[model samples]
Target chain A: MTQANPATLHIISKSPTHQQLYRDIANALLDDDAILFIEGGVYACCGTEATALLAATNNIYALSIDAQSRGLANTTPAAITLISDQQFVELCCQYHKTLSWF
Target chain B: MIFSILIYASSNSSQTEQSALRFTRAVLQQGHSIHRVFFYGESVNACSNLIVTPRDETNITEQWLTLASAAKLDMVVCISAAVRRGILDGAEAKRHNKSSANLSEGFQLSGLGQLADAIIMSDRTITFGN
Candidate 1:
């Protein structure tokens, strides 16, 4: 494994503008960094355009409660860690920095 | 972990601000330190103390004020977004010849660079956007 800066991204946008921004972020990021989708971003778990891009990345996860709240429990795609809030906090503790995008 | 919250939703009739508030409180309950709460876009109105909602409605501005006061959190309103959306503090309102200032107590108007600085200084920056 390559050693680099520990990074994580938290996305909570529930709007189209920010939805598009998430797509852009997923497309531009090539590193092995984790992404934790919460709030509106859970929609991407239901096969949004960004999902395909997420498949290519090695490290990424989505918040389970957020997805369930948005009625995406059954729709969450494979290879995603549907995390509880406690686990989400653990992710925050694990990563050195978090990039929050709307 | 240290955190900075970015609120991008409006103070006007939305769950965004309230959600952000709940999340911040949860973070604090977990023994985390909140470095800042940065308001942008329509959320900038949350800093205005002039907002007076009906008794039944939840007062987001007051909620923010209370939270900031209790925690001594650094509440920052985006200058660009505030000016564009007519959310002016006492000094800016006076400078612009506005009749009143509505900025919430303990909140300060600042540039977006504060956001960048928060990211640099914080371990986590959570965005609550709509």
Candidate 2:
């Protein structure tokens, strides 16, 4: 049987204004890795820049309350899954490790 | 699974600290366990007892204390970060000849080695910053 690769959950809390940060995360991501956007990072779920970032990983998530508070809840693309606080904890458990990008 | 959290955001400046606290609460609620919560960078300021939050705002430090007390969490503030930011414990205050110690109860001051240990001992090490 082929063993599945361990996945990482990347938690990002900075806005896309930090252009290099996105590139750094992209370079570091593996095929099985996922991204979770929280705080100011939820802003990435909107606008044109969201497309490129969304394409980077098959699994992209954003904190629902955070996106709601920032008025991006409805505007967030359908490609990104909006999760709750409880789900966030579950995601951490589902992954091998979590790397925060701020 | 065992988890360790590294907090680097300033409690006063960013929402990330509160976010970390909420995440911890959820972790406990889900029947998961936490090995430690390591406060580094500007987050060490959250250990200061003298920080008076305005009546309108939620006191993040007090919130952490309550949770830590209930959860029996090992909350460690980075010694170098705390001392540099004026968040001194009794021993540190005496050693440095400061007038008073303001480190909050339920939080201990330690070195980055504790962080290294947490990373090794826990199943996952998560960072909350900025």
Evaluated on chain B only, what are the TM-scores of all the candidate structures, in order?
A: 0.93, 0.97
Give stretches of model 2 more than 4 Å off: A1-5
lDDT for each candidate structure: 0.75, 0.89
**Regions more than 4 Å wrong, model 1:** A1-5, A10-23, A48-51, A74-78, B10-15, B52-57
Q: lDDT tens digits, residues B36-88, model 2?
A: 99999989887888888889989999999999999999999999999999999
Interface RMSD to the true structure, each candidate: 2.4, 0.7
Superpose all Cα atoms of candidate 1 onto the true structure and report the RMSD in Å to 1 decimal.
Answer: 3.9
For the predicted complex of model 2, DockQ is 0.90
Clashing pairs in 2: none
